[model samples]
Target: MANLYDLLAGGFPIDRDKPAFLLGDGSAVSYGELESGAAQVAGHLIARGVEPGDRVALQAEKSVEGVMTYLGVLKAGAVFLPLNAAYTPAEVDYFLGDAEPRLFLTDPAAFVAEARTAEPLAAAVPRADGDLASLIYTSGTTGRSKGAMLSHGNLAANAVALHEIWGFTPGDVLLHALPIFHVHGLFVALHCAFLSGAPMVWLPKFDDAQVLAGLARSTVMMGVPTFYTRLLANPGFSGEMAAHMRLFISGSAPLLESTFAEFEQRTGMRILERYGMSEAVIITSNPLTGERIPGSVGYPLPGVELRIGGGEATGVIEIRGPSVFSAYWRMPEKTAEEFTADGFFITGDVGRQDADGRVWISGRAKDLIISGGYNVYPKEIELVLDEMAGVTESAVVGVPHPDFGEGVVAVVIGAGDEAALIAACRAQLAPYKSPKRIVFVDDLPRNAMGKVQKNLLRERFGSLFMA
Candidate 1:
């Protein structure tokens, strides 16, 4: 595969004057205009001395400016590190120090005066086959954040695969509202859109009202489960939105079964939930026409290999594909542990593939709650809780127990009769699988990635289970 920019160049020759992006603000930019604007930005970065392989960090929201900044960094041959727009200044400083970026790009309104005084670096044409084009930081549930090194090849291959698998065409209008710093929005959304010459509708942040408006003209909409839940609650949601959509994809976090059921009932369209991460843009997705299972994330994408690693250690989902990141930046040991000898990326997720080829994610390998010597996946408990009346969300963790070694404890968000809810659990779940202790909270703690931080729950309530 050639450089990502080279792929853009081919698209450029086809019909450069065609519209490429349609902003939420009612403005549209043509591919010719975008290419020209990016070229100017690339020239500016070169004049400021940004060299190839050096990191250029972007701390901005989803806007035309943010898109330009990303393309500029890539065109200049520097690796782009797009930070979450919600990140604090201290968080920005951490990435700046870790990645050792040559330049920090920010929205003019958001720019801090200090960045202006930093020294500039030289820019040069990049080697398309080089090791690093982007350094994406994972949520670091295990510990501190580690940068996943994505090469030009890794990104290019993934984008092409998605374009083929999803049947994306140049005329497809993709509605994007997720944070661009993550793979769901960056690779699966933007990169795929760009490679296919698909037009994009951009929203700076997720707002149910804004999303509903964009869906008026969009052919596809992609988001996490939380986004869907919020949209379902909106009074503006009508069956018409589903009629205009060709594909509706979900990822970054699991789609709760209750949320899926509610969405389909209201809009008359079953969402297509897929599985992906920062390491590999996407591993699997449900078929376009076949059964779109409620909780299953579906089969592997074209050119992607997946399987459950069985024997002694079962249920660990492993992947081998062109889209997989080459390694974790500056962490050889950690990268070595994440891959198998044959080059499959060992995903931390615990899942199983059914005979029909549908994939069901049970839980995270690290989040497994071992109570009374039996392994209990938290997802099972959460699923049960989500189905119960009035329960909005739930988190299950292992609490200490002197008798059983560990006990199942559930932290939930709900109202009304607590005793009645427990009775409902008794009717459905096995006694051992039921929560030994239940705590009601306003909201569960979630990281920027929208994953529940069960570690925080374990730390705060672990002592309660002690004898």
Candidate 2:
């Protein structure tokens, strides 16, 4: 209904006395404290000449100070762009240039001085109009990456919708260990927590022992599939340690059926798998008290609409919602291609909604592979392989994996022998997608739609895959 700052102000007054955030070291911040902290940071940005709709870049480790900086930028009526702390200087420079932030708010001691030099240049120019809220860059299946422009309205609606659908309330406590740069960590975790007036116990990163201890105090926790697997590995995991938790949500990558079963057996908490991306934070989620299917992404959240195309359960997932991002930053043609005439964001994820209204994700529109919860686009690897000789054609697909979730395997149709093909690819592609075992295939299966069916290839080489 209102912008992020407006909603925070209204909600703050009612829950002023409530605890808003709690650090891992047992430090707590009240809603009233959070409000003032944000304002103080907002004052810093305002003094630096930051205006409404101006971009502010944040690169910091996950901490109360970092969280406050994010909210403060939003409160100042400016767009916030949080870079992954793990990003190399080159990657950081690319994002800073693309977003054109007014301020690069990072503790300079943590990053190289050269990386922060561009911040001064970005701050020199000022922008007007309160249209832009964020510019999140996502790696494309193609070689080029695009920045999705999220508006104030789009972000505001999503936080509210999440609060309504997920039963978030003032009483809830979320164990926040997700990265602050990603939308799930910021929008769904912090923004939604703000709306509910709930307290969050923030952790810098996911650590099984640390998270297990935090779960002893908190009621809710959200993580990717990889988080659950690592927790299950810790022999200390028990039903008693998980008794205090209210919910366990999994997303950012597909939840493996084995991981879900193992988690339930150990913790007695069923992992609620959900679907989301940079374009639209989250679309579907398992209900608080309904059928919790193992592999499904659950039903669409409030204010979200989804439909399956081509009469296939695993067709491209189309979503229309207020939370959908406005467009690609400064790329009008690319923005138009991302959404349909009726305004639905065409999620490149190939998925199908079951009879029970649960969405099951199959794969991506490209050779995009999700391994260990990180998105690895195969096109990036293919481009590397294309530089090598004797490589006629290369197709990368995810094979069933036990440890890493999905093993990036390649089936190559080459001009030379197996040894030569492997040697050529070894010189180029990343170790993750460089084909664990390159099987010689006569041809790749293509349907009437001219789409290469990777599933067929997977079935053909099922013996080579680790079950």
Model 1 over residues 381-422: C-alpha lDDT tens digits?
Answer: 889888887889998988889887788888899874667776
lDDT of each: 0.80, 0.72
Backbone clashes in model 1, listed as residue pairs: 49-121, 49-122, 50-121, 50-122, 50-123, 51-122
125 Cα displacement, candidate 2 (Å): 19
Clashing pairs in 2: 313-352
Root-mean-square deviation of Cα positions for candidate 2 versus the true structure, in angstroms: 11.3
lDDT of 2 by residue, 1-467 (tens): 34567665555538587777777677777887666666666666766788887888888777666766776677677888877776779878888787788888776233222322223221212222236777787743334567888877777777777777788877788999888778888888887677777788878788887888888778889887667867888888888888878889888866666678878888777888888888888888888888798868899988789987666645678999788887888889887887888888888877778777788776676556777786666545545544455554566777777866777777765655666666666777555656566666666675321235676777777666554
